[model samples]
Target: MSDILFTRTDERLGEFAVRPVRPAEDTALLHGWLTHPKSAFWLMQEATPEQVEREFREIAAAPSRAAFIGLHRGRPAFLVERYDPAEDLAQVHRSEPGDVGMHFLVAPTDTPLHGFTRAVIGTVMELLFADPWVRRVVVEPDVRNRAVHVLNEAVGFRALRTVSLPGKDALLSTCTRAQFAAAAGHAPEGSAAERGANR
Candidate 1:
C-alpha cells in the first residue's frame, strides 16, 4: 500500500493526496517529468532513469529529508520534497530550530488549468504547516523563474535576498505559519479556540 501522509481538498480542484515516494516504482514517471522542457529550472534535464532512481534512493535513506508524490484524485500530478534546513540548505542560509525547506514541481500538461499551480503550492504549504512544530517554511528557487516567484508571493513567501548556489542564483524566501494562514484565508492559529470560548 502507498504510505499516504495527508490529503487535502481544494474547492476548485477537488481532492488530492500526498504519499511517501517509492523510489524504484516512481523513477520512470519522475524522470519524464524532470526531463521535460518545462522543467528546465529543475536542473535534471539530462538525468537518466538510473540516475533518478539512485538520487531518490539516497533521499529516502536520508534522515533529514523526505520526498512525497502528490496525487490528484488517483493519478500522480506533482512532487514535493521536505528537508531539514540545518542539513540540506545550511550552506545557503542560517538554520533555525523550526525551519523546514521545501521544493515542489507540478507535472507538465499540454492543457493547463487556470489555478492549478496556485492550488498545488497552497497544498504544499498547508502540508508543511500541518506539523505543529514547523514554525516556518523556506524555499530557494531559481531567481530567473519568474512564474514561481509570483506563485510564491501569492502563497505568502517574502523574498529575503538572492544567493548564488552552486549552479544557480536562487531567490531565497520564507513563509511563517501565520503568513500562510493569512494568505490561505484561514484565521490565525489561536483564533479559532478563542472564538469557541466567546461563543
Candidate 2:
C-alpha cells in the first residue's frame, strides 16, 4: 500500500508491516480495540467510535507525531504511535536530543499466537531503529502495567524512574541501540542509532 513505510520478518512468525493510519477508514476497527477489556491500560475502555476517530484525527494532524497501523501477514493487528517526547512527555520526563517516544498496543484477539506480542514489539523496535537519527527510544508506560514492564525489560528498556503524569504514575524507560543489541542477543542491525530500524 502507498502508506506502508516499513516491513520486517520474524524468524518464527510471518511478516510485520507498518503503514500510516487512516483515521476515517480505521475508526470502527480502532474503536473496538480501544474499548476492549484487554486494552484497559490504554485508559479508553469506554471510548465511543466517534471518540476514537477524533483522537486519531488529532494525532494524525499533530506535527512531529504520527500513528501507524501494524499489519501481520497483511492484516491490521496493532497500533503504534511515534512522537517527540520533548513535547509529549515534556512535563514528566526530561528528554535528551534525538529521543523519540513510542507507544504500541496489540489488538485483542481470541486466536492468540504464542509470543505474538513480544514479536510485534521487537519488530516495532526494529522499525524505529531503521531511521538513522533515532538515537534512543523512549517510553512512559503506566507503572501498574506489569505485563508491559516485563516486555520493556525484555527489549532492554531500563527504567529511569517513576514519575507522576496528569492522570497516572508512569515508569520512564529508555533503550539504546547497544542495550537492545544485548537484550536481543544479536549484533547491531545496520548503522542503528536506536530510536530504531527493522531487525
Candidate 3:
C-alpha cells in the first residue's frame, strides 16, 4: 500500500483514501475508465497496456507532472493529476511563476452514490494546497463540462476567463487556499505559509 494523502470514514459510506498512482497494477481498470463515453474529454479512444504504462512512466519521469489514484474503501476509484500550469500550457498560456494545473477523472461506479464526485473533487483541491509553494490551483476545463463547472465553484474556484486550447475552448478557473477554506467550511490544512499572501 502507498502512503495515504487523505481519507474519511463515515458510517454510511465507508472509507475513502487518496494516494499516488500505480498504473502498472491498475492499467486495465484505468483504461476502461478513460475510454468510457463519460470520459470523452480524456481523448483516448483505445489504449493498450503498453501505451498506458509508457504514458504513466513519462508522467512519473517528469518532475512537473504528478498523478494519483483515489481509493474508495481501499479500492481504486479515481485518477487525478497536478502539473506546473506553465509547462502544461506553455504552447498557449504564457508561463507564470506560481500557477499549478490540475485535472481529475472519477471512475464510473456500478453503484451510484450522491455527492461522491464532490467529495473526490474536494480531496483533489486539498491535495493541491498540501504543497507550500502552490499559490494558486489553475484549471482549464472544457466550457461544455457544466457538471464540473458546478463542482469547481463548490470548491471556491472562480472563472477567470474563457480561453481556447489546441482543440477546445475552456473556462479557466483558479482558487487559492483562502477561497477554498471558505467554501469547504474548514480552515486550510498544513501551514498558512503555503497559501502565501497574494491575490
Candidate 4:
C-alpha cells in the first residue's frame, strides 16, 4: 500500500489522505492541471509532461521546500506545497522566524465533489498544526481568487495584506493553531470546563 499522511473521516466530511509527490508517476496529471485555464496562477500554460517532470523533480530536490499530493479515498486529487518565504519566492517579504509559505492547486475533476475542496484546506491546516514547530501558516493566493478568499475565511485565515510576487499580486493570509482548532470544531487549549474550574 502507498504511504499516507492523513486518514480521517469527520462527520461533516469524508475520508481523505495526503502523500508526498511522486514526480515520475504524476507528471502528466500535473501538466494537465497546470495548463488548464482554472490553474492560470500556476503559470505553466505551455508545459509538457516532460517539463512537468523536470520541474517537479527540481522541487523535490530542494532543501527548504516540500510538496505533497492530496488524495481523496486513494485517488490523486490535488497538489500542495510548503516552503520558507525568506528563501523561496518572497525572499524580500521580510519574513519572521515562524512564517511558512504555502500553495495549493485542486485538480479538475470529472464530477465535482461537494465540500471536498474545503476539506482539503482543513486537512492541510491539520497537518500544519500537527507539527509543533509551526505556530502559524501563511498563504499567498492570487488577489483575484475570490473563492479561495471565502474558503480561507471560513477556516479562520485572516487577510494580512496584498503583496507583489513574481507572477501576481498575492493576498497574504494567516492562520494560527488556535484559530484552526476553533474552526475545526474544537475548543481552545484551556477553558473553565476542560480545566475543571481550576484557578
Candidate 5:
C-alpha cells in the first residue's frame, strides 16, 4: 500500500503532502530535524538517532496518536503529530468530541524562504480539517516561544490560557475550521503573516 495519507497544494508553494511516519526509514531525517539549533523548542536537541526512532515507534504503535512526515513538493520538509485530545490533553484542556491535539516541526534549513513556514502550517491545518470528524485543532506550545505564537495567531489560533504540561509551561490554544478558513481568506494570498516553528 502506498504510504501517503494526505496531500494539499499551496497556491505559491507547489505541493505539500503527508505520509505515516516510518520510524526505521525516517530515523536519520527526523533525527537531523529534531536536533537542529532551530528546533530548540522541540526539546530533543541532544537526542540520539535511536532515541528519535524509539519516539516515532511509540507514536506508530499508539492507536490514539499518529505521526506523519510532511513533504513540500514531494520532499520531506516537516513532521506532524495528531492525537485525540480526549486521550492526550484531557488534563490540560477538557475533552471535546471533535478536538484533535497537534504538533508540527519544520526541518531546519540553510535557506529559509519568506512566508514558507506560514504556508507549511496553513497546509497542516488544512490537512487536519479535511477530516470531517475533526472539528477543531489544539496546540500546547512553550509559552516562551514567541515566534510560534505569532505564527499561530496569524493562522487563527486563539490562546486559551497557559497550563503546566510534563516538562514546560505551554500556552493552550485552539482553532476551528471556520476560524482557519476566515484567516486564510482574509489574507492577501501568502504574504500577510509571520512564520512558525515547532512546539
Candidate 6:
C-alpha cells in the first residue's frame, strides 16, 4: 500500500506492518479501539466514529504529528501516533533536541497473545528510530497506568517524575537510542558487521 511505512517480522510474533492512518476509512475501526473498556488510559471512552474521524483528520493534517495503523499478518492490530514533543509536550516537559513523542494502542482482541503488546510497542519504537534524526523517544503515560509503566521499562524507558497535565498526572519518561539497544540486546545500527568480526 502507498501508505505503508515499513514492514518487520518478529521471530515469535509473525509479520507486522505499519502504514499511515486513513481518517475516512479507519474511523469506525479506530473508534472501537479507542472506546474499549481496556483502553481507559486513552481517555476517549465515549468518542463516536464521527469524533474519531475528526480527531484523526486533524492529526493527519497537522504537520508536526502523524498517526499509523499497525497490521499483524495483514490484519489491523494496533494504532500509533508520533508527534514532535516540542510542539505538544513542551508546556508540560522540557523537550530536548531529537525528542519524539509517541502513543500506541493495541486493538482489543478476543484472542490476546501473551507478548503481542510488547511486540507492538517494540515495533513502534524501531520505526521511530528508523529516522536518523530521532535520538531519544519520549513518552508521558498516565500515572495510573502501571501496566504501561512496566511495558515502558521493558523497552528501556526510565521514568523521570510525575507531571500534572491537563487532566491526568503523567509519569514522564525517556528512552535513548543506546538504552534501547542495550535493553533490546542488539548491536547498535552500523555495528552488525563489527559484531560479526568480534565473533
TM-scores across all candidates? 0.92, 0.92, 0.86, 0.87, 0.91, 0.92
Q: Residue 126 of model 2: what lDDT? A: 79
lDDT of all predictions, in order shown?
Answer: 0.84, 0.85, 0.76, 0.75, 0.83, 0.85
| Deviation in Å, model 4, residue 162 alpha carbon | 1.1
Which 10-residue window in model 6 sums to the lowest lDDT?
A: 190-199
Candidate 6 residue-wise lDDT, 15-62, digit = tens: 888888889999989999999999989899988999999999989888
List residue ranges in candidate 4 displaced over 4 A.
Answer: 89-92, 187-199
Compared with the true structure, the alpha-carbon lDDT of candidate 6 equals 0.85
Q: How far in Å is the alpha carbon of 83 misplaced in model 1?
A: 1.0
lDDT of 2 by residue, 28-128 (tens): 99999989999988899888899999998888788888888889999999999899989888887788887899999999999999999999898888777
TM-score of 1: 0.92
Return model 3's CA RMSD, one decimal. 4.6
lDDT of 4 by residue, 1-199 (tens): 5456555454565666677778899888888889998888888898889998998887888877777787777788888888877776565466777767778889987888788888788777765555556677888888999999999989889998888888889898888778877786783221111110000
lDDT of 3 by residue, 23-141 (tens): 68878887888878888887776767678777877787787787888788888888988888776776666656667889899998678788888877876776677776777888899
Candidate 5's TM-score reads 0.91
- Candidate 6 versus truth, CA RMSD in Å, comes to 6.2
Q: Root-mean-square deviation of each candidate, in angstroms?
A: 6.4, 3.6, 4.6, 7.4, 5.7, 6.2
Candidate 4 lDDT score at position 198 = 4
- Write model 1 residue lDDT over 12-99, tens digit each, in one string: 8988777778899999999999999999999999999999999899888887788888888878999998888777677878988889
